[model samples]
Every structure is written in C-alpha cells, then in structure tokens.
Target: MLRRMFAPEGPTFRELAVQALSSVEHGYDLLAPKFDHTPFRTPESVLAPVSRALRELGPFGSGLDLCCGTGAGMDVLRQVCRERVTGVDISAGMLAVGRARETVPARAPRMEWVRADARALPFGPVFDLVVSFGAFGHFLPGERPGLFAQVRSVLRPGGRFAFPIAAPSRPGSAAYWMLAGFDAVMRVRNALWHPPFVMYYRPFRLSDVRAELARAGFAVRLHALPELGRRPDGSPRCRLVVATRAEAV
Candidate 1:
C-alpha cells in the first residue's frame, strides 16, 4: 500500500512512526510526497459535489485554497473563480509537490502558491471565496475560533469559507469502531510524545463548527451535498458548510 501511493522518498515506516509523534505541520511535511495516494486525501467524490455546489453559488472573483495540500482545492478554485486562485499551506515539502503539479493554463484563472500557516495568513481581505478540504482535523478545537477569524480576515465582505463535513459514524458500526480505535491510539501517542499530531475524527462536531464560525462573524449555512447519498437516518452523508463573512461596517 505504501509503495503504491507513496514515492520511494516518502516516509518509511520508521519515519512515519516518528512523524506521527510530531506536530501536525511537520507530520504533513513528512507525508506530503505520498499524501495524495493515501486515504487521507479528500476523495474526488467529495470534490466533485463541492465544485458543483460552488458553481451554483459562484462566479467568484478571487479564491483561496486554505491548507492546500497538493493543490486539489486550487483546482476547484480554478473552476469557480474568474480572476485568480491562491493556495496557502504551511508545509514547504507539500507546497513543493503542489507546485510541481502541472500548472493550470494561463487562459484559466491565475494560480499562485504561498507558504504560510493558516492561522496567520499574510493576504488582505481580497478573496471572494475560500475553500479547504480534508485538513481541519489538524487543528485543535481551541484553535478553531482563531483559524476561522483568519479565514474571515482574508475574505472580502460577503465572501465565503466552504468545506465538506461528512456525517459521523453511527455507534457500533465498523466505521465507528475503526475511528474509535484510531482516536484511542492517537490519544495514547499524544500522551507519550513530544509535539502531538492533533487529529480527531469525532471532536470536530458540526454544531461546534457552526458556533465558532458565527463567533468569527460569519453567517453560517449548511448545504446538503446530495451526490454523496444520505445516512441511514436520512441526514446528508456529507454537507458543505458555507460560512459567509458579514459585510463590513
């Protein structure tokens, strides 16, 4: 599995074991070479639904791909934004791989990659849309307000921050047990390690996320991405959280 998805230079078992014990950014840097191949990368299924939703709501002027790993979100931005698209990520290694990907043609929206922490973006309120995929679990709950504020700060009034959130697994299901075991292993790792990788599948509840977005001054809405199908309970299997920043004073 590792050989199929990860390049030879990609982290070895020992390297990954060490990286799992590091901070989130460093762990990603270590994993970047093989990231897209891993199950961790956001699937094309989710991306297609999100792109369709944004197309319905957009024609956005400029877009930002937050924590863009390997430029998947930037590709979505290219399809939606008319003016320009920028990808910002903290991992130089990841950004390098992203940059190595064939650039979108000049006839398309201009593309640029910036290396920076999401919590401290350097751009002004210049983006009409901001989208992220599969990177939120890296942030601790306490860090969410500040992170949302950062996203808000970079977006123009009425611009949006959008990302997909899948429904949590029902208790006693195989998926639930797998995630539970993973979380337990992570907790033990963090307890015994130095810089901990902050990823928890369950803790990033949608309710808490909506509240945090509101606290950051965004008007939050959840759009069902029907292409992903529905849960047994009939709730959307996946949703796009559209957090629009209120118009400035």
Candidate 2:
C-alpha cells in the first residue's frame, strides 16, 4: 500500500489517471519514464534469486525477455545465456528506456530490443530460454492459452519458458480483499471508460495457468523460488513455473 505513495520520479495521480484512460500500450508508454521508480517494476529481491536459479539451470545459447518492461529480466539472462539476449514489448517507450539500460560484459551476448506484441512476436523458434516478470495481469483470462502458445512458439525444442508466480492470497485475508477490490474497481472503470485498461489481479490462478500451458504444448514444472519463502501451510509463497517445449521424437 505504501509503495503506491509518492516517489521522487513517479507519475502523479493526474498523470496516472490520464494514462489509465488510454489503451494498455499507450498507458505503459506514458508510464515508462518513471516506471522503474514506481512499484510496478519487478524488485531486485525476486530477480536476484530467480537469476541464481536460472544460472543453475542454464548456459543457454539465447534468451528472450517476453513482455520485458524496462528489461529488468535481461540482467538475469545476461548472466546465464551465452549467445544472444533480446527484450520484446509492445511499448516503444518501455523499449527505449530498456535500450538505454544495456550493460555489456567482457564477453557479452548479443543484445536486441524489439518492439513487438507478445501475441504476434516476429521470431522463429530460436530462443533457448524465455522469461517474463510482472506483466501477466495485462493479459485477460481468455488470452492465456494464446499467450502461452506464443511463448511456446518462440522456444526451440526442449527450451524453457519460466516466470515466478505468487500463490494466491488466502480468502478473507487483507491481501485477497485488496486484490479483489482492485479488480472490482478496474472492472467498473473499464465499463465506464474507453479503450479498456485490461488488467485484473484475480484472474490468473496457478491451476488454470498450468492447464493452459499444458494445452499450449508445454510440459510444466513448478519449483519453489525459496527466496520468496513458504506460506504458513508450507506451500511455496511463490513458485517458478518452468514450461518446456517438447523435444523432437
């Protein structure tokens, strides 16, 4: 809740209101300049441990950061992938900020920033690994299978599509109500407004997502992202879903 408060470079309420009135692509474009300062960007705590896990799982030849807002996930890919790294998003403003953030090592992979919609990516099945963070809420529930198919479509045989998914907040809890309220407000806003902001926190359940990934031809595995820790019931608070495209028979 406090994270939604004022930040030195964060957008004002008026600016955010205007952005919310726009389409999703334009809204993100409007938000891109100060996106890193806002809480919407993926935090280092999650990224670091996910990076550690990726490094253990890979020496990947190439990687793509799907829906890469400001390219935060590229830092993880840079450490693990050997041949090439790419960040693709529909927002040119986000990609512009991300391009300025490029860091090259002594022997770095090739880097490319492509402005492309996630649903209609302009690439062959070439990436060895793919990852996304904090972007799925932008997609609708009905869009999940198509979205997963697109991710799977870009992966080479046996390549992995990975992302961290938080366990749903327990019912009747403050967290659950916060999410429920947010989605309720968003629904009303979209109903009353134009262009439709198209975000909802409650729709992306893990069970449904796993089923959709399976339907999209991915063999899915969930590994505890132990850095995010376990819930009181001992289930992981967050799990890294690794969905691999099938290898040729």
Candidate 3:
C-alpha cells in the first residue's frame, strides 16, 4: 500500500532531477501536481497520531499549517481546531493544489490558503495553534531562529506550535549514510549553483532546535507519539515538540 501510493503518477526520476536543480520555491511549484503521490508528502500514519495528540491537547480555536504542502497537515488541523484553519506556503502552485483538496469536510473549520514565506508570515497574533510537518529541512540552521520567531509572532500568547521530530538513525546504518550522502551532494550543489535549493536531512538536532525555540520565547515540551513506536534504546522514535507562547505576566 505504501509502495503503490508513492509509485503511481508520482514524479519521475528525470522530473525529480529537474526539481532538485531548480530553486526551492520553483521546484515545489513544478512538483505540486503529483506531490501527494510522492513519499515527500507526510503520510496518514504520522498524521493520525499527531492529530490524536493534538486532539488530547486541544479543542484549539484557530490553527495554522505552516508550509502546508497540498494541505495534508490542514486535514489534521480541521479535525482538532474549532474556529478557523489556514494553510500557508511560499509556493503559489502548492497552495492552488491544496485549495482543491477534498480532505476537509464542509462542516469542518473554515479554511484559508495563503501564499507567503514561512520566515515572513503575513499574520499577527491570530492563531491559537501553528503546526508544521516535513518543511523545516529547507531552512538552514542559522535561519531557524528567525523562522521560529515568525511562528511565535503569529501565534497568540499561550498558543502552541507543534511538529514532529524523528529520532536520528544510528551512525554507520544505511539510513545514516543515505542522509549523509544526500547532504554532501546538496552542499556541493549549493556551492556551485546560484540560488540554493536547501533541503537537508541531518542538520536539525533536537537540542539545538529546543534552544532556538526557547530563544524565540516559546516554552518547550516534547510529547512522545507512542503510536510511531519506540527506538531500541527505549526512547520514542518520534516526539512532537509542543512549544507554547508564554502568557503575559
């Protein structure tokens, strides 16, 4: 089932190569048609558990899907948030495709699709929750502070910003080598290319990320999504970072 979804009508090798060579925003625009069919789209397995956790945490009012590609995360927000849901991304093509998604029911939260960079979100303190999935890799480590601050700024005080972070694959493992090689190739590509298409696999560390979030004025906590199961070391394979904006003193 997983193999079939990612295999059918998804981007071809040549198409993926073209996208890799293109600028980040333009690459997504090119891939928007078949994005949902690609493994790049966050799967239902992860979404289901994330939504369940958010449900237990919430009844949140307004929600934002930061960098929502084809609105997969928006569906989760619809189920958990009551007032309104917004999906914002830099790619207009992605937003257009997401607008046509049938995942959200008419009775669900009212929805908005906005085209904007995540680093420079065009919203004030209006959202009670902001969630992002699988989109952080595009930003360099230096960019995380400003990006987190932007999410913090858009969220109302006491609101939450949530996303999943998977446990690192053990060193010398196949997954580790694959990710390391990918990042190495990307580094070479960016050094030679004009506008870098900056998707990286290994740069986001939980400790560094927590520090950045704290610097952005968020009180951070990690909720283990046990449905994803645990690592051999007994730690969770994936944990949701639930960072809340501090209430006024």
Candidate 4:
C-alpha cells in the first residue's frame, strides 16, 4: 500500500523498527524518508473535511501550521491566508522533505518554515489561524498544556487553533482492539526503553483536550464534519476542534 516501496531511499524493516524504538524527534527523522508513503501520514480524507470547515470560518490574514510534519496543513493555510503562511516543527529531516514538495500553487501566499519545538514556538501574536494534523499523539498528556499555550502565544487575539479529531472506536470492535494492542505494546516499550516516543492512540480524549485548551486560555468549540459520516451511536465520526483565543483588552 506504500508508494515509498518503489522509492530509491525507502526504509528497510530494521530501520523502521529502530525508529519505533527512538524518541519522537529521531523517530520522525528516520521515518521522514518514507513518511508520505506510510498510512501514518494524515490522509487526504481528513484534510478535505478540515479545509471545508476552515473555509467557512476563514479568509484569515496569516496562518501557522504547528507540528507540521511534511507540511500537509500548509496547503490548507495557503488556501486561506492572504498575507503569509508558516510551518513549524522540530524535525529538520521532515522539514527538508516538506520543503521539497510542490504542493503549494505559485500564486499562493508567501511561505516560511521554522525549526522549533511545539512546546516553545519562536513567534509572537502574529497569526490569525493555526492548524495541526495527526501530530498530537507525539506529546505526553502532561505536555498538552504547555503545547497548547505555545500555540496560543503565536495567535493574535480572536485567532483559532483548529484540528480534526476522530471518534473513539467502540469497545470490542476490530479497530478498538487494534488500537488497544498498539497502546499496550507502546506502554511496554516505553517501560523498557529510554527516550520514549509517547505516541499512544487512546489518551487524546476530546473532553480532556477541551479542558486543557481552556486552561491555556482558549474557548473551545466542536464542529462535526458530516462528510466523514457518523458512528453507530450517532456521534460524529470526526470533529474539528476550534479553539479561539478571546481578544485581550
């Protein structure tokens, strides 16, 4: 299923296994060679729904893509921002690959990339919109507050920090079992290894996320992306969390 199998620089099994055992930054650097080919890259399915939602709320001035692995969300920013777009992440290898892509149109807003950790952005209140995709699992639960605060710091008052979140799978379902097994293995691996990856699928709950965002001074709103359909319980199959910073008086 991976297109990277045909690429000249694709990773071997041993390289991937070593990546899985490394810290988050080093793991992504190792995976950067074939990241777009893997299922781990945020699918276009999720990106489309998020773009549609942002269009309804936007025509924003400047935008930022946080933890912007391979700059997928930068495409969204290019579409919505009139002035400029910026992408920030800690992994230079991933950013190198992202810079090589021809995804942005020629007439799009000016784009810049910064190499910085999400916990400590090197920006001020300059962005009117901010978005992240599929990168939250890299942070431990204890780090969420600081990460959210850093994002908030880069956004102008009334700007938003938005991203898509999928519904949790029902207990006993195949997907649930798969995620449970993955998390279990990850827990064991972290216990046995130094520099843990901190990528658990279960700890990113919407309720907890909202509370943490509020603690970082954002007012949270959830919008259902009906295009992705609904679960059996009628909850949205995926939601776009829109956390807006109130205007500072």
Q: Which of the numbered candidates is closest to the native, going by highest lDDT?
A: 3
Q: Tens-digit lDDT track for model 2 on 129-197?
A: 999998899999988888988888889999999999999999999999999998998999999998999
Mind giving the per-residue lDDT tens digits that candidate 3 earns over 172-239?
A: 99989989998999999999986889999698999999999988899999999999999888999999
lDDT of 1 at 173: 96
Question: Candidate 4: RMSD over Cα atoms?
Answer: 2.1
For candidate 3, report its TM-score.
0.96
For model 1, the superposed segments whose C-alpha errors exceed 4 Å read: 1-12
Q: Which 10-residue window in model 3 sums to the lowest lDDT?
A: 1-10
Error of 4 at 183 (Å): 0.9
Error of 1 at 241 (Å): 0.7
Q: Which regions in candidate 4 have their CA more than 4 angstroms from the true location?
A: 1-10
- Candidate 3 wrong stretches, greater than 4 Å: 1-6
lDDT of 4 at 171: 91
lDDT of 1 by residue, 171-197 (tens): 999989998998999999889987777
Could you tell me how far off, in angstroms, the CA of residue 232 lies in candidate 4 after the best superposition? 1.3
> Which clashing pairs does model 3 show?
none
Between candidates 2 and 4, name the one with more favorable lDDT.
2
